[model samples]
Target chain A: MPNNIATVLSRQDTWRGRSQRLPRRTITTGHNNLDLLLQGGWPISVLTELMPQQSGIGELSLLLPTIKYYADNNQLCVWLDPPYQPYAPRLAAADIALDKLLVVRSKNHAEWLWAAEQSIRSGALLLAWTKQPPPRYADLRKLQLAAADNGNAAFLFSAPSAMSAPSPAALRLELQSLEINQLLLNVRKQRGVAGGAQLQLSLGEANTQRTNLALLPADRHRTYPVRQFNN
Target chain B: MLKRDIWLYLHFPLLPLEALLPQLPTEQAQKPIAIINLQKNIQRVLCCNTQAAAWGIEPDLSISTALALCPELELLSRQIEQEQQLLQQLALVAYSFSPVVILTDSGSLNHSSVPSNHSSGLWLEISGCYKLFKGYDALLRELDYRLRSQSITAVNGIGQNPLAAKLLCGPDFETQLPDQTEIQRRLLNADLSLLEINRKQQQSFKQLGLNTVGDLLALPRSALSRRFNAELMLTIAQLNNEKPFNAPRFQPANSFRDLIQNPQGIFNKESLLFPMKTLLQHLCQYLMARQCHCREIEWHFEPLIGESQKMQIQLSGSQNNWSTLLMLSRLQLERLELPRSIEQIILYADQFIEAPMGVFNLDLFDNQKTAQQSCELIDSLNARLGIDALSQPILNQDYLPEQASTLATPGKHSNTSLNKKLKAPQPLWLLTDPAPVHLRNKKLYWRQPLTIISGPERLCGNWWQAEQQRDYYLACDSNGARYWLFRETSSQRWFVHGLFS
Candidate 1:
């Protein structure tokens, strides 16, 4: 194939068409450890909702890793919330720099959604989030569309166990701390894989890795977490 | 090496998701679920399609209007926190398959983010995913399969870029790559309008004789940059997979507002409950933060000099979370005079203080549990069957059978029975209402009944509806049933009301 034809044709080929779908993408989550678990870092334009960490669970702890990852990737990581609260002190604990973090807090839920929807649609982040609950289908759908449109990943976190109902989400996770500092991450509901299991592990920060504790949920089997409700 | 980048767009119908919406009651989830954009307290439905059509509601319908169309609809409050969580879940699920997943909102997925009204969408760029998630087909299959479980309708479109992929999702339009080459040969041709070209921009482009990116590409890149901003340049760059960094706009700081809306124009008691509950909660929180007492009243009438300022508001009260606010709102509602068309309302208290009432320690935990259980039952029933479906018989002093019974409206008619002698520590499972039963020979007996429960105890309410208070009987039926059976004083009408489960 002639180089001239390939370049001009390729450029022309990408000329304004209604629909375009790239077949493959690299997943880059702003963290080395999580990327290992994900097989890739946060894939560009994918969505990841981080659960809150209670006690030592450190659910919000992962946000820093992902944010730092994005900052390293030269992508903007926005946090839409009360702004005053950021893991500045905690960043050093996770080997993260506070400058990589983008703080965004809206006056209300509507503004929050609006800002999130806009930010996610921009495709300019390793991650962006707000401490709000997505109680409506439209808001989720809108954010989903924005993520899809921008070809950028979006992360939305809700406080205090908000992922109760099945939403327009790809992976819904419920993270809690179990006995003796073991983290109980219930892939409560996921779109593609069966995730119903207790990803039990004790974090030894000194080593900076989550050692394999146990893949619980012997009776039921699936990839994505589907377990709901603690009986 | 920072490997070469690729972007993919996936589109899902917001409607087809019905089959996969998890275990939401048919009456609730199947009904048109409008994700609303609540502005200044007024909510507007954002997306509408065939799925919503099944519910007989259209896009742009007001929430109340949507309710009017589908009264049985299940409505989850519009909380962005929850919605974003859902989107994140979806994005993460897709992440498993595609390494690069760009999120996009359907509303703006095809529209111009740089030049348009700043629309939002989920435009996932799943590039370089061939090795990670098998292939595009596998990725799509997994995405569809998962979306179904969550009751989502997805429009799948595989294209070269997020914008192009989003445009490909719709079949009504022909999708393809603009320039022809072997790689572009497989691509479908699509109109530029599918990019959600702003009407104003589209007109401007047509006027300028630049119909498509192809036309714009024909111009020198330097001239193009000089003629127009990077908006056109960026979109062009995106089509070619040239990375475009979206530097977001600056958001200002300083937040927090303390205020309350009044509950005056609330005439229909049952209908007013939901709005009252929401507002009262907000008010209570406000008062608590201010540390004050609430005693007076103020109102912000609606249809203001500016219609958007919010209608006749219940303007007076302690903006604090307290049971008193609930009671005060109820009282104000009871005394309110409905205007020709009541709008927004505000409330303000004349005097209030840090009068934090002491918590009355109660030792009646056992009895209280049962009472709480009954209240929860009533609330759940109201939630399911609607408040209008509930009623109990209340008797009056009148001996006439016709004037002996009335409806025991829930949440109202607080005093059940006035006869102090009839007061006893009855089981909380007492039936608030009663049903008619056929007697064998003018004698009340449960021979054949649907449910048999508790409450032989008697009760009475406002006799305006109907009345006939008498000694009640707790009886069981032939089918292992339990019920509260009672006979009217003069009418001899046998009635049963509830079941204890």
Candidate 2:
């Protein structure tokens, strides 16, 4: 072989032997207000549990801004199993484009994992949602590897009353409805930070006015609508 | 001839006769034990050497004749199919060395251009393998080492043609390459036998002085063709590498496998996160063809040679995604002890909630995107929080839009909407189970003194209750915010429930 071609081949081999590494970035929920309230936007490297209000509260509304942020940023926000139709009209009313949301409907248990794996491996997807239980160690490791390999985010959506399973997430959360217009969001457990302090909030009115009248007195309400910022 | 045009044919006996010798009965390792294949009960001649002389068996001899010569001879069933598979495996392994590796039919090899280990059992056509592999010698050593590691043994031969290499590299060659002149001279000499055609032809050839390979070749080409049949010319062409040998074609089965380096990422860690999205994409494609969606996915991971540990989750509404299930699993998986290194991940999306019921083909221009947007919005919140956290209120049976403003699960249209009281557009705010504030002298200071601008628009119901004869009023506060208040004459208590501005 000619020296030049040999040299080129050698260089190519050397280059390929060590793949070009992509930079790992930290995930930040786009809503500046909510992001400030969360621990670097819901623990970038862990799973944060979501507790819905059994008595109808602001669960959906609270996460809208964040979901919208991801969708706008070219990140895929997947909702594996959702109770209500993310009525595109309602979501559009909230100003979210349906195209940015990848709605997946899983048929069985096996497929849930398969889909999770697929989403995790896509590298370009910003988020994947599933209603399945937490992953086992191997898949969790795969997820962590994926997190390290690709700078994407993944999330699991399950019921509040669901039984506990293993966790590979950095944080855990439990939410409850405090009053008609007040929601109680609590961090049950967090990996890196110790987070348990109720931060209060009221459902911001549609007209953008303060509706302190709707918020029950903190002392009066048994379950206070709170944000566990310390976590 | 161009050097590049020199095609070297190579073949290797996967189950070398030497390797099988000791496994056989007695010290037959030294016996001339050749492994022959039988097709339709007819034993076809295969490979043999001086070792079989002890048993008095030779190549081309039928099994019955060999058995008669040696009473203790062992007979084995031929496994051509198994041998073919094994050889194909060997070929695949060999292909890794060079893309140019081709199966040779003559059971021999030619690699005269490169010097390689005689015991390596690998024949390298350096010209082609050199480019793919770093060097011709490197390729030979690699193939040799790989084959040895696989525990397959063979005799290596390198030459320029099938006949030359096979005839030279046998046990008879003393493990040395044959000289080109000696090989060519022998081949030429053998050609003289071609004159021994049919009985009458043989007699004529003998009379004409043709007896050996060299003598047969000495005849002019045109004269030989006219005098003998086409087989005579074909034999010579094969000897001179002029004939082509088609190789056996084969295909392999398809299999899907994944190597999960860290399965704990989905379990032990909370704050549902996926480090890899590529895996998700692959998984999506795999499941897409099955026409299914994952509702509840669980992960069961097994380390190499270890027991499987799986985490299961229940979802209020099942979703098909990596993050949702992972997140659910993350919280539940915090305390699990992971194996040293996970070999595989088994994911179970057990909760199979069928696809949501919605319009697949809505008027494309209907532009009812708001509903979908709300649905998506509700889904996300439900993901991080529980399902009950979100709701849009429905009025009670009071025929009141104000009551309808009470928070209810977002989409369900319960009997609350059926109430005749909620016929008109209502004020945004509505209080449930109205609270009472004593009105001093029928003048109440509720949310700024309603200037008493609007009169009591009275329509009384529930009068049957022995409680009170209630009077209703649409009172306007000085601030233009109208209030809907009711009075209980018996208790003389006034309550504010909604507004009209």
Candidate 3:
């Protein structure tokens, strides 16, 4: 291969055809089915746009495992303009370190994008959400470049309407509720792979065990076997 | 064998003019300017610029004579305070070269060669610092370059002690010093007027046929001790290195406070950037010399009219880098609105703390470096936006969802632990205030009719306050969007409290 071509191909952001795929670094999504669908897991050091059909529907739950992974390893996690206040107890219960988490609320669209880009460039796991005045294509591209340069994962949450427009995100997934405990993920776009792949994942079971254990009274303790008096 | 100390003295011949030149307008600075001192009701010229000197103006010339010599000469009264401040600033520069720096008091030298109004001088003991700066020549060159960049002109001389160094510092001083024997030879040939003696003593020396230091040294020690006073004898001993010269070392200020005045007034906000950058650079240099970091800096802008406006920039972490500080200050200035034309700008930073070792690292895998970068980002964001824009979620020991968690300053660790046993999963997003849900057709409706996927988890708390008793449920809308809903038992009102996302 020509030296220039080789150098260009060596870049992490460069995508090749499936027949000559390059191995990329990724963080496991903690779900076997989703990981299988993503080949390994969520691609690292790139933008991942998660467009849910509506609010909730287990959208944030899908990222809880990834956030916990980074937070546990002492990496910073920045949340830009989250829709509502992040429930601390829920995050703590999921074993995510609160100290490693930074929540930033920007006053305007420009500041929001600036904060998102800065967070990504700092090599933090960035989770940003777009508001009524959605970010433009150029803004998302800037964020994508920052993530690729810093080698950190950035997940952007936007309305489902964004799925119709093209984006610079390496991975674009449309999330929907398959059932109360299950979520359906449609791969709208992905790098170096064919898109339109769908996967139904059961996310409710992970928290169901915790909820059941929590239903038990706080005073409940393991019973000790009574020793009969020496007859 | 004992090693001899090498001393370097910096003499500022035109310090009074140079000290105030930065504040003058360009057009005015280009004209011939002279600083005058009043002694016994007689005003005499103390220092003059090259333009004034070209017109026959010299130190000790009467003001009237100087004016007659050049009608365009601009006379300024001597500012002792400004001269002292400039000396301190110069000392800071010298301190960077060597840890031992001494500041000479102005008007302290009574020698005929030294002017009565000559500003203070700086003495640096550079014997131990030769290797650090490669060599004495390189050290001198670096010091000269730094001073020139600040638009300051200084003459330097080298000797075995402070007095000898001061005597060697004249218009004929050499940049490269000679060997010890050669230095002694030059000192012997130096005129007696260079010694720290009054005019009467110099006249007495002249009458006694003592023209050069060699002539005086050629006399008997008993005759010299009997003829000269104690001060002159001590000065001679210090000059010969037979006696040690003891002076207090210069200590850098603990805080940084510098002011830049623009006489013409800065009408545009963008015009303040240059002065702001200069001040920040000096501040960073001061912090580096002190081996500390400043967490907050306050900028006071004195307008031509009205009260001065104050802007304080706070950093999430301590910083000592000039470019970082300048960038942060620019971001803040972009948002500030000046009330009137700014006449002066004062930068003050008093809260300094010792910077942690290895605050910057090149290792890609270092966790501390990553944390520091995150801190820098937080600071930038907070500088442009408000400080309250950034926060970290912290859990509180309370049953109510709103009370269970609150936002705190970033990096603040909360001591409240999660209630492990209260396992009903909380939504990831909680509304600041619950929105009431409407009931239509006897079904729960929030934007649309909702279906309850799970039952009530009764939570009752805040008995001391307006008590709250609600039954929480997980519900989904027609579009499969899930929400956290609750119904108040007393009011029978259903509301949407959070989202699972």
Candidate 4:
């Protein structure tokens, strides 16, 4: 009986309890504690869903390090249907190569999905946001397959309400902010791992302040000479 | 020892009729058809299909006579423009086999029964290329197969000189050539009527008892020059390889333009894809032959009832592959809603760039492969969506958040450096226009009540233009959403500008 059990365990398709024999490839998430909570870092070649409770909650800041890593490696990073213009100076300040970054705005849901699928199939790190008439479950499955085939990471952002909906994403995280620059991440789904893992991360500038010298009374009323035009 | 040159002549006897046959309906194309031209104020038949000839209506017959012979004969006026275009297209096909291809319109030299604009030919210098195709037989076989696939009827001839090649191309001429002496013997027996000389010259030859080319060659050259015209002497010199036959080398068109007509009128937009694919394949062949790549292609669709519609498909990068181009064209066509049935489709591409050498490289580790894939994805997206749909974020050196960054077309590299001197962290998303914050009961309310976290970082610049002064802050709403807010010191009004996410 012991010999039979050993042979069965030696098979390549054998599933082991409490541990994964083939761990997924990952890229660091820039935060040590969050990386540790996710078991190494953000998974590669799979869909990772980030559902933030609201906008402006350090969600993009969390992925900044990974995006920077891809851009630095001369790989393309595509942003599809972002809600607002991605401030280039901020990304540039984060050391992301602007030339390697593509921002695609699709006119309709179908175009958006097509662009997302094409981006994933091209092996580019895709970061897409769900808009009106959100993608169906089948669309996400297609994207997951594309990501798996291309061996690239694709991150999808949706409203926090999507946390309860079924998703094909390999990793699903519910994001909320405890305070300014402080993000709380609850792992809702993870393949081959237990769910309900949570971590808190301090994201942007923690303690930095600059005096409002430009708004002082003397500068408030500063005036400049107007240029004269000849007729 | 110097090797002699070998020339191949392809004579298209019914080019005028064949060029216009593709534009006709299936039923109309099968009936008796004849191409007629005005000769001395008389409508004379230039060329006719076998169906017409079966009714005893042959070339040089008057139109009235032709009508009498075959009352159902369909007479079409000779189209000089179409014939020229078809000749050029054939020259391009011949160019694929040999580098030196010469296009000739032998309408004037043809028999009086088949006058000018009725026949055309392409001469290919094949001595250097036959070996590349393995042998002369294989080369000729391949050429014949290509022409046959296009429904082109050509008379093929081979000779040591261009004139001999043309003269040897008879209705009963054999493709297989014997020794040089046999070829000479055949050339000697060729009738004087086969020569390009006019009727007057032919009569002069017959009056002098020179019926065969050998009979004329037997006469003294000085005597023949004194008796015959300069044109006859020139023809003799060219046939004997004494004078060089120098015509312009065929240059493939810099741009690709081809037209396809559907008399049945394609009603469904999807049906247009089949014909569009064929045109794209031809365009790819043209590009490959020229070693060039095109970035834009204009598709003009002429409908039966409405004005012609034009759709342009522009690629982010120059591409010459048929599959890629066809895919892009398909994407573009899917979005086009045709108002009427399409009668004709003209594909034109003028902008061409030399294809890079690395484009054909199959090296696994070639870094350009990834870049090319990225460009292809961008092109595919842009084709389905508008060109403005895709862009790259570029940073600018300025103080204002809106002025510090801008959107540029994809693939544009930015060289501007961010102002790192600002210590405060910048927001990830910025609104095109700031939203005003409501102050109720002395509390900042933007969707909800806001609580200031830490800011008051002043970003005051552009004083020379609009003279602006504002105090910026980092604030959080009741839902824990961080907002980049600012208060105009002059107006004492507050607005939200960006999101920290």
On residues A171-226, what C-alpha lDDT tens digit does candidate 1 reach at each position?
Answer: 55666655322445666554334667445544323334432223322322122122
Q: Per-residue lDDT for A116-139 in model 4, tens only?
A: 999998878999999966688999
Q: Given candidate 2, what's the lDDT at residue A3?
A: 60
Best by lDDT: 3
- Models 1 onward score TM values of 0.29, 0.42, 0.89, 0.86
Model 4 chain A lDDT-worst window of ten: A222-231
In TM-score terms, candidate 1 sits at: 0.29
* Residue B224, model 3, lDDT: 87
Candidate 3, which segments miss by more than 4 Å at Cα?
A: A1-10, A14-19, A205-231, B106-116, B172-174, B217-222, B359-365, B415-422, B439-442, B451-462, B469-471, B474-482, B487-493
Task: Pick the winner on lDDT between candidates 1 and 3.
Answer: 3
lDDT of 1 by residue, B43-107 (tens): 65655545567888764567898888878554543444434434544554555454455555333
Candidate 4: C-alpha lDDT: 0.80
Clashes of 3: 0
Compute the lDDT of residue A125 as modeled in candidate 1: 56
Off by over 4 Å in 2: A1-26, A60-81, A84-196, A200-231, B12-74, B79-127, B140-230, B234-501
The whole-model lDDT of each prediction reads 0.45, 0.46, 0.81, 0.80
Better of 2 and 4 by TM-score: 4
Interface root mean square deviation per prediction: 25.6, 12.7, 1.5, 1.4
